[model samples]
Structure formats: structure tokens, C-alpha cells
Target: MSDATLTRIAEALERLRPAPAQTPDWAAAEAFVWHADPDRLEPVAQVNRVDLPLLLGIDRARDTLLENTLQFARGLPANNALLWGARGMGKSSLVKAVHAEVLAQNLPAKLVEVQREDLPSIGRLLSLLRVAPVRVLLFCDDLSFSHDDQHYKSLKAVLDGGIEGRPENVIFYATSNRRHLMPRDMIENERSSAINPSEAVEEKVSLSDRFGLWLGFHPCSQDEYLAMIQGYCAAYGVKIDADTLRAEAIEWQATRGARSGRVAWQYFTDLAGRRGVTL
Candidate 1:
């Protein structure tokens, strides 16, 4: 080949190849988010999370996750955790809150959030995190698999970690509305259609089993819902009479047609705005 042609081809090949993933300065922030399409980790200066004490109605989940996270941060053995259950019941929030709590205790832990769609890029992301100096609480919110979804295959990188195994400093915490990480009908369909029904269903449902800890969140009771609002009002110093607060909080949930920690926060937010309180 002519020298000019060879030079042009070399440059073209270089342009086509992706650049190495650059690790961010971990000291810049306590939390980061993984993004694909030229994969990068973007630091979050301020994480939008409720205070640990403010999260009510999930005390058991709260304590269990906190302990597990603390153990990880302290460089002890910990399990991959799956926070699964009812909608708006603080599954994701508890993960964030627990990270904050760990930081409060001066533990060397950082939070990294990854979107469900970007899961296919997780292996590349993990390559960067595995060498990180600090412990990583990798979080994925609202995780679920549909009947034909192939993204769950990529999740094995987090669960099994291939030959290297999951990085010691990296612990995973995922939140899902479905306990099995897939729909009931999907499992039932596999049960009926596959030649070996048990094996087929097991392959799908076994993803949740991979997690050593499965913390379930359930719907809050009326009293628990009201208590959550009152706690918010107290924490933010938004004052209202007991009678009025009770009546308004109940009406708010009635309009929404459900009761949960999120509903309480929404009601409390409205009350705070009306009372000229900034949260």
C-alpha cells in the first residue's frame, strides 16, 4: 500500500475504536451515576434522599439493609441485597438513606446508581469500579424482567461476576416491585410452555435467589401513613394542629386511592408549601 493510504487507514481505525473508559476522581463526590452511550460515571453533588429517620413503616428493612451496608463499608463480608415489593414503599429510598447513614458514620462507602436500560454495559462499568479505592454501593432502581427481555443476562455480571467474582469493595442493592424480578404470568407461561417446566421457571426465578438478602417492603397501614406525614412535618418544622393534619392527610391519600410512604411525603410537601416552610 502507498504510505498516504496506509496512514489514512490507520487513522480511520483509531477513530472507529472506542476510547478507554476513564475513571472519575472518587474524592469529588460521595455518589455517582453510571451512564452509557460513551460510558461514564457522573458524580452527584447532592443526592435527593429522605433522612434515614424520616423513612417510616419499613423499620425492619431499614435496620437489616443498614447493618448489611455497614458491614460492607467496614470491609466485612456482605451479601448482594434485593429490595423488592409494593410500589412506593421506600425500597429505593432505603438504599439511598442507608448509604447516607454509612457516610454519617464516616464509613468509606460511595453510592453509584445504574439505570435498568444500561445494564448491558455493566461489565465495563464494573471493570472501572473493581479498581476503585472506596467501597461502592451499586444501586439499580425499579428492576424487572419481561417475558422476552434479554437484559437479565447482563445482570449476571453483578450477581456472579464471571471468573473474577464480584469485587470485594462493590456491593449491589437493587429495588424491584416484583419479588421474583419478573412478572407472575411470565413464570407461569414458562412453566406451561417449556419441555422441562421446572427448569425453565427456575432459570427465570433463580435471579432473585442469587441475592443473599431479600428485603421485602409492604403497603403501609393507615396509622403508619399518618405517622410518616407527621414525622415529616415535625422534621421540617411545618406546624399544624393534630386534628387538621390528621384530616388533611387522610383526605390526600383518599384522593390518591392508596397509602404509602411516598403518598405521605407528597401530602407533607403540600402542607409545607401552604405553611411557607422550605424542605
Candidate 2:
């Protein structure tokens, strides 16, 4: 090849390659999103989260996670927490709220959200966070795996930390609808197909066991659901008669065929809109 052509090809190849992940300005924001292609931590000016007090149900999960996050932020011993159970019961919301609570108490903690697909790059992300001055809450929301998916293997880096060990300043928190972080049917399938059924299932199911704290979320009661809407209305200053609010909220859930903190919020959102209030 001609020298000029070779030089041009080399320059083009360099441009095509993804840039190395860079540590961001820790003070830039309280929260960030980890993106992998170019491997950057993008700061978020504001986090879209309900206030801690506004998360009415899942109080036990909320308290447990908040305490764990506070301990980690303060450089105390803590556990990698798995918040798993019923959907729309504030599992993910609890994680964010706990981080916010840590900040509220004047602790130096930053929240970095990682998408499940970007988990393969978590080692790089951890490398950046390992040197961070402030504590970091590494959060993954709606985490789950299909039968054929291998992303769970990457998650072990966060949960188990391989040889280098999890960073002292970083704590992992994940939310999932499944307690095992995978479909029950997937576990069943492995059991049925593998020659060593216990071994096959154990490899996958054991991932959840790696987390020291298992916080379970369950469906809210009727009163709890109504209370959630009421709290929102009060917090946002959307006033309505208690009877009317109760009746309307019940009707709303009936039509949707599900009652959850999420459903309550959805109903409250609609109510606030009709009342000409902004959330």
C-alpha cells in the first residue's frame, strides 16, 4: 500500500474506535447515567424521582435500603442490595429515594444508573468510580435475564467484583420484578434440560444469593393504594374531598384491573391535570 493511503486508513480507524471512558466531574451533578459506546458518565441536572416521603408503600424496603445506602455513603460496611418483587410497587423508586435521602442527610453520595445492556462495560465504569472522591450508588433498574441471555455474567463484576474486589466507595443496588433476577420459567427450563439440574439452576440462581440484602416488594393494600394517591394530592396541593378522592381512586384502579403505587400515581397524575395543577 502507498504511504499516503496507509496513513489515511490508520487515522480513519482511530476515529471509528470508541473513546476510552473518562471520569466525570464528580461535583457536576448528584446523579448520572452511564452510557457505554463511547463510555461516558453523563451528569443529570435533575433526577426524575418522587420525594422519599411521597413513596407511601414499601416502607420496610424503603427503610432498609435507605439505611444501607447511608452506611455506604458514610464509608461503613454495607451490602449489595437486591430490591425484587411485584412490579410498580416502588422498587426502583425506593433506590432513587434512598440515594436522595443520603444526600439530604449531607452525605457525599452520587447515583449512577446503568442499563442492563451496558453491564459489559461496568468494569470500566467501576474503574472510573473506584477513584471517585465521593461514594457512589450504582443503580440498575428493572434488571432481569432471559433464558439465553449472558448479561447476568457481567453483573457479577458489580456483585462479586472479581479479583480486584468491589470498590469501597461504590455500592450496588438493583431492582427487579423477579426475586431471582430471572424468569422462574427459565430456572425451571434449566432444571428440566440439564443433566445436573441442581448445578445448572444453582449457577444462575446463586447470583441473587450474592447480594447480602434481599428486599422484597409486594402488592399494596387497598388502603395503602388510596393513601398513596392522597399523599400525592397533598404533596402537590391538589385538594379534593376525601370521599370523592377515595371513590374516584377505587374506580380508577378497577378500570385498570391493577392496584399499585404506580397505579395510584397514574390516577393522581390525571387528577392533578384536571385540577390544573403541575407536578
Best candidate, TM-score: 1
On the 0 to 100 scale, the lDDT of residue 177 in model 2 is: 90
lDDT of 2 by residue, 10-70 (tens): 9999999988887799899999999999899999999988899999878788888888888
lDDT per residue as tens, model 1, 77-143: 9999999988999998899989999999999699999999999999999999999988999999999
Q: How well does candidate 1 score on lDDT at residue 170?
A: 95
Candidate 1 residue pairs in backbone clash: none
- Which residue pairs in candidate 2 collide? none
User: What TM-score number comes out for model 1?
Assistant: 0.95
